[model samples]
Target: MTPQYMNISYHDLLKATSGFSSENVIGTGGFGVVYKGIMAVEGIITSVAIKVLNLEQRGASRSFLSECETLRSVRHRNLIKVLSCCSSIDHRGNDFKAVVFEYMPNGSLEEWLHPKESMNSQPFESLSIMQRLNIAIDVAAALGYLHEHGPVPVVHCDLKPSNILLDNEMIAHVGDFGLARFLIRQANISSPSMTSASGIKGSIGYIPPEYGFGSQASTEGDIYSYGILLLETFTGVSPTDERFTDVSSLHSHVKMAFPSRVLDVVDSKMFLERQCPGTKTVCAPKSAHDCLVSVLQCGIQCSKESPRERGTMKQVVRELDSARMLLLR
Candidate 1:
């Protein structure tokens, strides 16, 4: 059956989201708060992430509408799916708006990577090298789809690990389109006014140098952010660390460390028991050293300071695919 497009009413959304109860709330950000919700139609249950706007806040309505417009028009497997939206006055007679998205049970990549809170007795296992490579490929594919397959090129202004969610199947989904922008014909333009208190457009560590130079947000900026994410995934360290503060950028830090055979910076959890004898916690594959080398090399390429020097998402995806195939063999 074809899925009919219908705007969800505000009342229906409230019931689906349990009246936006705090217990159901899963996450919150500058744009809005996200709540876990269940919807049943024809006796079929479906889980969703409901993003409810903070109407009392300034500029919240515009951001909500902007995200709605972007997600409603774009579609991709790696991108979060927006099922519907609700925009109406609530019982308090205040404006209410929300977006319903496919729920990601596993939560954001940041939780897995940094984990602010301890995962006591959670049977937490570090992701294998192969798993990391697969996630990078999935994210690249999603970005590629947005830049090439969509009706208009979309720039995900904020591409940090926190915004990348992993589903139950470990499939990566790019979420938080609140800061996304459409890239029409490429031309120089002034930076968009910053919305947050930081006075910075993108996340601090991931913001592209080009953006500082007054270049408008472009696909290249997204590429730069992707590179930072890749580096963060490989190395358990945050991009802006006291050690790396001396270095001009994350790219340079990684590049200098690469020549020293210091992939040891990679997450200790990722290698664990797999680490080679007489070495640090970093692991070396039994027979796929070449594959590991390739993946690391791709990371280096992506982290290049010059956007023109970095490989496209298509190329990144292909490289990861090749590495994954080698690891499987």
Candidate 2:
């Protein structure tokens, strides 16, 4: 069902965010800054995340329109919901534009994976094996819906840990649709169109190899990005780590130590937390070890250098669910 959009004004948003105060700033990105605000929804005042676009930046206005269009067309619990939009002039007489969304209180998956001292006020806690598994499934399901089940198949174009927000229950919600594309299906073929004419649409490291060679945005590209995100979540390492210099990409790095040596690169905190108490051996529980291996295998399969070799989001979701069941039993 389509959500009812609240008609808001520049003054209303200004009041909601305290004139876009520095204290309200929650996140910063290429196109704009996200501010936490409170706005009345159906007569109840609720917190929201407002993405204020930097109109001065090239392509920023276009991004705002693209995100609005894409969000209006798609609806999924795993995908971020757009509450309202503002496209009026600011008090300064300059153009103002923003997209209001449901605020994710738990923050982003990136914050949990790589916490910085200044990033969060609360004590840092590592995500458990179960939490990570669930998050992965949530994201894969979202992408699968976007790629296959939605009324209009949309290409997220940008899929990364930073873009994955966690709600109060830690359920993952994929955000940042500024680079999204609606694929035009012709028979069995998806139309070809570059996300950006001059450069790549997504962040470095998350972008698929085919995109670099001028391949158009496709579901396969999103799958490739998802694969990298899964690998990073397990390993607790960034794809752009300095060690990944030269021919060594995240996929290759994880591939080299896969299966038998998988434990070597796995997140130490996660492994230790799952390790049996007072145990001296390097091994984890047999079920857990098997589960980790299977999960990593999915990541490996999804992040293949060749798009054709990568698994679909549906396949990834199925494999992850199987791993989750293995851990449960």
Candidate 3:
């Protein structure tokens, strides 16, 4: 069942975000800016992430509506929670639209994957092999949920690390539905709503090859993206890394070194943490390396160029579970 939508007044949103100041800004993308704010709800102070739409940008309004409609019906532990929304007019009488969500303290998976130099010149700790496994499963479960429900399977057109948020407990939650689409199986393809107007395939490097050729988005495309994200999580490389040339990508980069020199592509710091155990990140058993190999194999399979060749989310979920089981043993 779709959760009840909470309607927030524009004045309350302005107050919650402190006039939408730059200091409170937590994230920004094609849609708009997300601000971390404290708002009193039912006489209790609460932390919330307010995503204020940039109406000046094309499709910003559509993104808001798409997110609202999609998230309204779906609920999952691995999915970002939508607390409320403000769709009223601003003080200037201009159009105003914003969404309020549960504030994720750990920010995005992108931040943790590629940590910036901190104030003290130290980078944030990398995610452990176990943590990566769990995060991958979390994401997979969310994607599977989206594809399994309703009259049609929902395809998250845009899937990337930046869109995956982590909470205070390090639990991963998928966010940002600006480019979400509902696959209309009647025509055996994603609705033209995605391609007709803007021809948006997806973020560079993360886009499936089929989508580039005007193929409608599908569950297979979402799986392909998940494969790239999974590879990046293990290798600590971004799909958009500058080193990839026209003939190569993160998938190819990892493939070239797989089985023989898998560790070469694996994040050096992360490998050390996994191997050393108590030094930095949490430690798993010795089978961790072998488990990662199998996990990478699953990623390679899901990211296959041919949509027919890609495994279903059900298979991907099972393989990830097996990998995690191996790590524990």
| lDDT at position 119, candidate 1 | 30
Candidate 1 per-residue lDDT, tens place, 184-238, comes to: 6535643222223222367888888878877667777788888888878877677
lDDT by candidate, in order shown: 0.76, 0.89, 0.82
TM-scores of the models, in the given order?
A: 0.86, 0.94, 0.90
Better of 1 and 2 by TM-score: 2
- Give the alpha carbon lDDT tens digit for every residue of 67-111 in model 2: 999899899999998999899999999999999999999999988
Task: Give the Cα error of residue 148 in candidate 1, in Å.
Answer: 1.3
Per-residue lDDT of candidate 3, residues 55-113 (tens digit): 99988999999888878867889999998877889999999999999989887888888
Model 3 root mean square deviation, Cα atoms: 3.6
The alpha-carbon root-mean-square deviation between model 1 and the true structure, to one decimal in Å, is: 4.1
Poorest 10 consecutive residues by lDDT, candidate 3? 189-198
Candidates by lDDT, descending order: 2, 3, 1
Candidate 1 residue runs with Cα over 4 Å from true position: 1-6, 41-43, 56-58, 117-124, 186-200, 246-249, 276-279, 286-288
**Candidate 1, residue 232: CA error in Å?**
1.1
Question: After TM-score superposition, what is the CA distance of residue 118 in candidate 3 from its true location, in Å?
Answer: 10
Task: Please name the candidate that would achieve the greatest lDDT relative to the true structure.
Answer: 2
State the TM-score for model 2: 0.94
